[model samples]
Target: MKLSWSVEKNNQLKAHPDRGICFEDIVAAIDHGGLLDDVAHPNADRYPGQRVLVVFCNGYVYGVPYVQQDDGTLFLKTAFPSRLLKKRYMGGDDNGKKS
Candidate 1:
């Protein structure tokens, strides 16, 4: 998948306080990290015309918000560290969900 970042996403990522994590980090994680799931953004008001791809990377869960164009280009909207842990991406018996 081809990846690109929007101007707003770049600015937001630069302003974020998450130490050692940059736009490159999010891109690398999404490229090599384990994918959790792809779902429509629950808060459509905040993430318009985008979906969220949850990924497990470096023992942390990162939510990558993006949109895929008709030409198969991925336009990354933004990314943030989710409160979930690595275990959430593992396996679950009760919920029967991997993530």
Candidate 2:
């Protein structure tokens, strides 16, 4: 899938160097068959236009909120690491409970 993000958003993401993740990482993860799943944002009702997806890549999970353009490109609104998502989707025990 094609991916795109605004320059401003990119700048905002870059500001946090500690995150150790970039747009290229996201792309590579997707290219290499990273697991993708659609999820409802906590504020879904407030932002109804975009669909949020979580992806697992390189042992890390990211929350990617995006909109599919008419031309089929995914316009990524933002991306950030999500521990809650990783635990929920990456096949791990929840609070010591077996799956």
In terms of lDDT, the best-performing candidate is: 2
Give per-residue CA lDDT, model 2, range 3-86, as digits (tens).
Answer: 998888777777876455667677788878884787666677887768877877556778888888999888888877776777
> Candidate 2: which stretches are off by over 4 Å?
91-99
Residue ranges of candidate 1 with Cα displaced over 4 Å: 11-15, 84-87, 90-99
**TM-score of every candidate:** 0.67, 0.77
Clashing pairs in 2: none
Cα error, residue 83 of model 2, in Å, equals 1.5
Whole-model lDDT, model 1: 0.67
- Scanning candidate 1 in windows of ten residues, the lowest lDDT window is 90-99
Report the number of the highest-TM-score candidate.
Answer: 2
TM-score of 2: 0.77
**Overall local distance difference test of candidate 2:** 0.74
Q: For residues 1-99, could you state the per-residue lDDT of candidate 1 as single tens digits?
A: 687887676776777667234567766777774677887887899868888878766556667778888889878776666654334565433222222
- In candidate 2, position 19 carries an lDDT of 53
